[model samples]
Target: MLVRKARLPDADSIHALIRSLSFDGTLLPRTFAEICENVRDFTVVENDRGEFAGCGALHLYGPHLAEIRSIAVTPRARKQGAGSAIVQALLAEADTHSVSCVCLFTRLPDFFRQLGFAQVDRTALPDKIYKDCANCPRIHACDEIAMARGVLPDIAVLGPAQVEERLIPLQL
Candidate 1:
């Protein structure tokens, strides 16, 4: 399989993969518009025949915090290393940008553990909860685990104390 930065033409396929998982409530739903707007954040994996295999996105929240979102592999492509390749590519992109840390909310903690992400309390990332989880239907009964990797240069950038102090209630 080949992995590369996503292009506009890849949006439809990426959206389909994400939509399939989201339909089962395994991931957050992303609209075609949303995918297009953040298209640059994604990396796509394509099979040798040029079929889309999987996709993931790195969303920068601030100088020190970025979140990995919308990771999904085609069901037929699962266990074939497509998921790992997509994540590795996203993390590598994060490293290239010198992002201090990468965070994600997922049900697959084991998968992330293999990628060096450690389980973190959701409370530890109030900013993320406030920004995304608040609007999520599962917020009150979330089954997803929060995980992170790398060192965040400035904890204050997303510290709960700081987030509360500068809190602005609005839909993000």
Candidate 2:
């Protein structure tokens, strides 16, 4: 499969893929407009025949932090390295921008562990907490484990953890 940066035309398919898993919280549901707005943040994988295989995104919170979001491969694409390739592309995207750390909330810790991420206290990602977590219905009882590929250079960059700006409204 060829892994490359995602474009505008790819948004609908990517949204469909993520939405398929969002109902169970395997991924957070995103709207078509939201996907278009963040399309620059994503990288997608396509099979040899050029069909959508999987996608992942690198969302920057600041110079100190970036989060990997919506990484899901189609059922037929799993175990074929499409997911890994998309993740590696997302990591490269972070590195290219000089992000000091890359963090993600996932139940699939082993999958991320194999990609060089280490388990981190959820509090270590204050920006994520300030942004996404505040809107999450499970804030008081989150099941997802937080993981990071690098130490956050400065937590201050994340701002206040307990306060929510509600800057971006998300759909569960």
Candidate 3:
């Protein structure tokens, strides 16, 4: 299998893969337009035959934080190291951008733990809270665990004050 930065032509496959997982809320649903608009953020894995196997995206909030989102592998590609390769490639991309932290929300903590992520309080990720969690359909009943690799950012650019204020009651 091979992993590489996603190209425009890969958008349909990536959209389908993410949509397949989103049906049960395994991931947030993304429109095909969203995938195309942010296609540069995605990395895709292809089987030896050069067929699309899986994909993941790295959304950089800044030098302070980057997020791994929309990560999913086709059912047939599971256990073939495609997922791991995609993640490593994303992390490398983060490193190239000098991002200090990488975060993700996942139901599969064990999978990410093996990849060097540790559980972190969702509130500790203010930028994420502001960007997605604040309006997430599952906000009050979220099942995904927040995890991070590397030092958590000390600051947030997107409404940190508002995120903190809103999250306070949730923590209580």
Candidate 4:
């Protein structure tokens, strides 16, 4: 398998991959336009024949914190290491940017735990809760667990205060 940074042309495949998995509510659905806007945040894995197999994205929340979003491997491609490879690529990208830590919300905590991630109280990440959660349809009834790998710099001092001040206090 080959893994590489995603290009603009790869957005459709990436969107389809995530949409396929979003059926079970394991992932949040993303629109084509959102993918286009954040195309640089993605990495994809392809088989030796160049078929799109899996994808994941690293979303920058601040200089010190990033979130792993839209991670999914094609159902036909499971158990072939596509998911792990995509995550490894995302993590490597985080390292390249010198991000202090990476966080993700997943039902599959065991998968992330294998990658050195530990479960954390979601409440500790007010920035994340205020950004995505406040607008998410399932925020009031979220079933996912939060996890992180690497030591995060104190996010309060890492710029989240600005985010908190701007929060609109939506009821989600």
Q: Local distance difference test, per candidate? A: 0.85, 0.88, 0.93, 0.85
Better of 1 and 3 by lDDT: 3
lDDT of 4 at 102: 90
Residue runs of model 3 more than 4 Å from their true location after superposition: 160-172
Best to worst by TM-score, what's the order? 3, 2, 4, 1
lDDT of 1 by residue, 58-102 (tens): 998775778999998998888999999999999998888888888
Runs in model 2 deviating more than 4 A are: 158-172
Over 49-155, each residue of candidate 4 has an lDDT whose tens digit, in order, gives 89988899999877678899998888878898888888988888899888888999999999989988899988776667777776677888998999988875476
lDDT of 3 by residue, 46-131 (tens): 99999999999999999999999998899998997889999999999999999999999999999999999999999889999999
lDDT of 4 at 78: 89
Candidate 2 per-residue lDDT, tens place, 1-172, comes to 8999999999999999999999988898999999999999989999999999889999998878899999999999899888988999889889888988999999999999999999998877878887778667899988899999987646645455335344546667
lDDT of 2 at 11: 99
> How well does model 3 score by local distance difference test?
0.93
Clashes of each: 0, 0, 0, 0
Error of 3 at 162 (Å): 9.0
Using lDDT as the measure, the top candidate is: 3
Q: Which candidate is the best by TM-score?
A: 3
Poorest lDDT segment (10 consecutive residues) of candidate 3: 163-172
lDDT of 1 at 10: 92
